[model samples]
Target: MRVAVLGGGLQGCCVALALAERGIDAAIFDRNDQLLSRAAVANEGKIHLGYMYANDVSYSTARMMMQGALAFAPFFARHLGSSQDSLSISRPAAYVVHRDSQRSPGQVSQYLKTVHGLIREASGRRGDAYFGRDLTTAPRMWSEAEREAEFDPQIALAAFDTAEVAIDPAALAGAVRSRIEADPRIDVRLQHQVTSVDDADGFDVVLQARCGILRERFDHVVNALWDGRFAINETRGLRPDRPWLHRLKYGVSFRLPRGTSLPPSATFVSGPFGEVVSYADGLTYLTWYPVCLQGISTDVTPPEWPTYPAEPLRSDLLQGTLKAMAQFVPCLRGLDPGGLEEVTVKGGVIVAWGETDIYDPRSELHRRFEIGVTSRGRFHSVDPGKLTMAPYFAEVCAGRILQDIVR
Candidate 1:
């Protein structure tokens, strides 16, 4: 069977890999000249376990995230042909509660305990399936003294040690690219911008390439574009019923200064705070929500910006993120001016359902459970929700497409 998978981001790569494993030929169409060049590579690759969604009081977001987190390592490792233990995992993150957080430390703590309970319950007999580590252990909250030592006492109220870690997106992209290049069943059509997908006997995928327009028919089509997935979905008459949002956020990464003691991988939660991830490969990533988030669009597709922003804006984001992060983690103050190396600031588009910013308690962005594959016949549109859910949803999409063949 022939399949066309739009967008060469993590979701599209996973979908193509899954189908190739099943002996199905698939083509990945992406505007970028390389796979995983956009959101897949630009952001902090947090493999979230739902600790960030304390605003979703119903715990539905926690449940959905737990399901995906469990399957992330195994599914990704299998497709990448690598050992789970070999993945370059960041250090265990400390969830620091900001002083001006939307949810109080007590409330966020309760939510963390509840989410951990769900994770333990979900693991069942699949011990150590999550990144090859036991997830049954309860989360540990730091003492007042412990929190005060690492964080500014005025900005950080509490901190909890959780097993949540992020995979290095560069390493992941390289691995996936190697696997895709070696596979004969997957054809990657780079620099091909898919303008639309029309439903006929199957699906006609119209592509606007540098040369000219090209059309191709495929038995199945997967809309997985990180930047323009919604726009393509609308062309296929698969408009999202609920309100949606497309946000642009930036991630700043640099090498830690020589002789600098690395700060713990940390995420400020329950508000519009930020995260600092120090990966094992010596790449430290920082993102301050208030400073690094650039724009928002209610339109079907977000405005296009260069992956690497220009000089002054890029420098501004770097300095601003460092300043904002140092407010909570004081160690970052030293690395801002001239202590760091190879600093880069890049932005990626985040698509989710919400009209309000994250600071609002009533915002729909707090709950991200309303995402996955929505299919009409053989055409599939995927919203992986978060980067953590990509591999899990890819498997689901492949299974659904296979089932369509039987009917």
Candidate 2:
């Protein structure tokens, strides 16, 4: 069957690749010239272990993520020329220390036990075995001596050793794209923006180009726009009735001085401002990636977000991030404050709802409805783990499409 997958971003690439693997002819389209550019330039590129979600997770989103992590490993090894050695699995403990009160030792143990149980069950293991034996935890109010002991003075009740895997998102996307392009059945059209999709005996995919409007007929179409669902629908006059579209926000990342290290590997530091911080690459790079609050909306592009200098310097947001870093890493206060060099920010719309959004099948409402009925079926709305979970999603979507065709 001929298929058209819109958006050359990570999701679209994966979907196209998966279809090609099934011996189905497929093509990919994207409007962005720099589809994987931002992720390639910035991000420490950590491949996440599926343990982030709880054991009782029943949502399609969660299943896709879990299955994707497992699927991506072999796909990367076989197609992308990635080796198992390139991957580093670490159990970095995460902690949530209260400001005023102390959690009892029993409470800490119980918490860890619950977490361990969840991880074990999710990983399909029996008994009380912890998923990451190296993972451990400790809780204590920081003494002044303790404050001076580590790089981050504010750390309390260190939650140590949670399952985390880091990989380059850009490299992963490029690898998948390369593999798909190698297949004779797959045709990748870069810089081609699909404008509409119509089902007339079959599916008619329309594209808007500088010269004129272009159209291609396919047996099926899949929309894989990462956070661009609303924009695409509006463009096609097929906006969903429900308020499913999420607000757009920016993720700001800055390159720290070449050699800084945080003790106990990478940790997510919770700040007073309700922001999360993580250290990577010998602590030389710190990201103040903002988790956009739910229900907030923005039309601002990444390059237009508030910046530091008139020209290419550092972003103002990055400066604010450094200030926050100083609260925990006091040594930062003594370092020579240099101008922000090469600050790359990725601005896109994201679903900012609570944890429930990640695993809900209803969240796929727009995608499912758009595919079969509307000519606007060429886009996909996905959650945060789109890159990590693309393979599973592709399989599921392909299965659904096949079922529909058969029926």
Winning model by TM-score: 1
Q: Tens-digit lDDT track for model 2 on 1-407?
A: 67877777666666666666666777777765644542222344444343332222332333434445555565545445544334433324343332321333345445445644444445564221222232233223334565455445344444334444555443455555556667797787766766666656666777886667887887777777655544555554655554443433343444455654443323342221222334454323344434322134433121222211233324444555566555655655544445444455444434333223322423332121122212324333433344555555666666656666567
Model 1 Cα shift for residue 243 (angstroms):
1.8
* Per-prediction TM-score to the true structure, in the order listed: 0.97, 0.69
Per-model lDDT: 0.88, 0.47
Residues 371-391, candidate 1: write the lDDT tens digits.
Answer: 899888788889998889998
Count of clashing residue pairs in every prediction: 0, 20
lDDT of 2 at 43: 41
**290 Cα displacement, candidate 1 (Å):** 0.8
Candidate 1 regions with alpha-carbon error over 4 angstroms = 83-86
Q: Weakest 10 consecutive residues, lDDT, candidate 1? A: 77-86
